[model samples]
Target: MKLKLCVSNTDVLLSTLSAIQPLRKLCVLRFTPVHLCIISMALNEPQAWCKISQEVFPLYEVESIRDNVLCVETNIDPLINALRNFDKSNSDGLSIRLQRRPVANEGPESSKKNRSMAVLSLIYTEHVSMASSRSYSFKIPVKVLKAEIDQGIVEPQLTHAEVLMKLDRDILPLFRRIERYKRSGYICVTGTNRGRLELSIEEDSRKVQLSWKEFLQVQQLEGETQQQSQFSTQDQDMPHSVQIKLKDWRLGAKLTELCYKVVMIISENHALVLHCILNEDETAEVTYYIGGKIQDQE
Candidate 1:
């Protein structure tokens, strides 16, 4: 398996990794002929999923016999730290190459048990002068998946949500309010298809509610999205409510800072999706999927 990638505009990658870095978990790097996807899937933590097209990168190549795709999971902090310290102007372009480290802690067996075994080396070529140039490499350790054994992942499929709204306000303050409730382990969100939303949490004898009267609705495709008349359709007008983990909700809030627009999708009491869009062209996006709190979990 061989995979190499180079991007002229590192802003997309930098911003995306920076946003999701707060999750502090290993992220999956999926390299295909078409695009690259960075994902972090966890049961108790917020799941972050995003896609970046090959067109976004001037150089993208992947070679593999099975499925013609390569998937590796690794910690993103090193890469983020390297980019943070690197001078963007001096960067000719960032080149990535996959390499196998002798001892991997990915699976069951390892020497130290905590060290990463595989890596995607980050190579930066810097031109010092007219004819002088310098090169630096940082090995961002990864866990390469075995194509024959591991089933690749796909984006989660959700039933059409009852309400999807375009939120324009910052959500940081809302999360701050929820933080004060020591007894509130979860946050209850109620909303209508017509753009009304309510977020609240309860602490022992106290209750705090934050409401928004109106907001822009998400544009839908012919079958995907349309109008849900609040007046005519009784069910459409009825608000859908779901309780999500306060911790995950707060993590979702961090995504808003990385996006140009924020969209919330609710599915009654089943699940919630926080769609964070980074660009208008849809070249890059980071979305968080939060499952509703189950009774037994409480």
Candidate 2:
């Protein structure tokens, strides 16, 4: 299997991977014929799914064993650092290709047949202002997907919420009040369809509630509104809330740096989905699925 990607827009690709680093350390890098997908580890923390189209890379090629899909597991830090260095190099061209290296094991069935390791070879040309140019290449080891193990990785099947809220772009200001309290580990986020969102945390008798009332716009999911009824009950009138760890919540908050618009889809007591729009056209975006925590109120 052979895979090569020529990154045309370094900024867009950099922002995408940078957004994923907080929540995930190691993620599967999948390259399809038309898209580059990042699948986070199936852990208890927030799971991320980022899809960027091939248009970002003018020359995107993959010759994999199955359906032209190449999946390899690698650390995100090196990839992020490589892109940062790409700027320092004043790179004229940047490309990444997959290479195989043979490993020496003590016990081998045949000397001719040794275990092969997969690596991503990053190659770029650096142009110096002194009318001098140099080339650089580095290898990042990776683990190729084995059969159905990683192929089974899929987006969380979240129960759709009819009400979707377009959060304030500058929400970091609101988070400051709660961030100062080191005693609190979790925050209760409650939102109503009436454009009100309340973030509250309680430790013993001391309580703090920060409300963003009537400042945000709430809407229905594209195909979900039709199924939900417009009835007012004690349950429906109550705000949809989720108790999530502050650390996990910050992961989604970090995405605002790359995304144009930050939307939140909340299924009370179940999960909170952050739909981050990377571009105006919405062709490329990231979906962060954060599961709710069921802890005692005491």
Q: Write down the TM-score of every candidate.
A: 0.83, 0.87
lDDT of 2 by residue, 195-257 (tens): 577888878868989987455787845454434345543234347788888787767776765
What is the RMSD of candidate 2? 3.2
Model 2 residue 100 lDDT score: 79
Candidate 2's TM-score: 0.87
lDDT of 1 at 98: 87
| Cand. 1 Cα-lDDT | 0.75
RMSD of each: 4.6, 3.2
Worst 10 residues of 2 by lDDT: 226-235
Candidate 1, residue 32: the lDDT equals 80
